[model samples]
Target: MSRLSDMLRTQRFDDYRFYHQSTINQTLHLISAIIFLGCYALLFTDAAIAGIVGWLAMLTRQTGHFFFEPNGYDAVNDVSNDYKEAVKVGYNQTRKIILLLVWGSAPVALYVYPTLFGLFDPPTDRFDFVRHVGTLWLAIGIGGGLARMLQLFATRDLTTGLVWAFKVLTDPFHNIALYWKSPLKLLRGELIDSSIADADWGADEVEEAPHLT
Candidate 1:
């Protein structure tokens, strides 16, 4: 338990220090986190609505990473952007692009093949088509996470895989807790998270970063 807890903290700290150094990005994550919570609530009752809401949150979160966050030599962390991407435990930019392409293709594929090559029943109307898309999206989201988790199990270790999966699952609540002050900081014209420089994580004690496989 202690080891799991420590690794979780390290991963979260690294994520914030390495990736989320922009106030705008942090603020967007806050909004995304809230929307994710809504998606979570709708998950059991309406999978279709849950999938749509979940993707909306994901768009906000990824927009921050793709557009707002700095992707240069990270002076604060003393590492190059390439180095960070290589060591990222979860989806790096390259992997994210592939996942997003698959996600984007699902709707188009559904549009062309209404029954999705017999995977789903033919839609009766536009609303049904959208519902089918959402259901397929929900499946894709789950399958993507599980596929990565299994990959990690083969590449890293069981504990690392499980910990990353747990972190992903609980990120919404955690993001709210971590980035709630980001909007105020953005309002104050602080574009970057200056405090990140001082967030020392005992460099000698913790692993420098996760090993890429």
Candidate 2:
């Protein structure tokens, strides 16, 4: 139990330090986290609403990654952008791009095909169409995470994959705890987080980032 806890902690730490150096990005994550918690609650009541809210949360989170997070060599962590992506336990930028591309095209495909390549029933109205899209997006969200988890089993190890899956599911709670103060810092004109401590700790966690197969 202790070992599992430690792995979760380390995964969260690595994710934050490596992926969320920008204060703006952290602030967006904070917002996403809050919405994700709400979506979690909604899952028990109205799963359709949960899926819609989940997409909103994901959009906010990815917006920060694509537009705000730093892409240069991480001087604090003494690693390059490529190194971090290669070692990333979960969706790296390349993988994320593919997911996002599919997400972005879903609406278009639905519009053109109406029945979405015969997967969904033809909608009677716009609201039905939107509901269908939301459900499809929901499947994509769940499937993407599961697929990556399985991929990690082959690429890293079974334990690493399971740990990462847990981290991804619990990230809303963790992000809320970690980044709640980020917006305040941004308001005070701090555009980048002072991640020196995180970087130092990360370096100790792994002497060299392992290249994935």
List TM-scores for all candidates, in order.
Answer: 0.96, 0.92
Candidate lDDT values, in order: 0.91, 0.85
Off by over 4 Å in 1: 200-206
Q: How would you encode candidate 1's per-residue C-alpha lDDT over 110-140 as one tens digit per residue?
A: 9999999899898999999989888988888
* Pairs clashing within candidate 1: none
Q: Which regions of candidate 2 deviate over 4 angstroms?
A: 198-208
Q: Write the per-residue lDDT of candidate 2 for residues 9-123, one digit (tens) a residue.
A: 6777678778899999999999999999998898898776787899999999999999999999998788899999998888999999999898888788889998977888899
Q: State candidate 1's TM-score.
A: 0.96
User: Which candidate number maximizes lDDT?
Assistant: 1
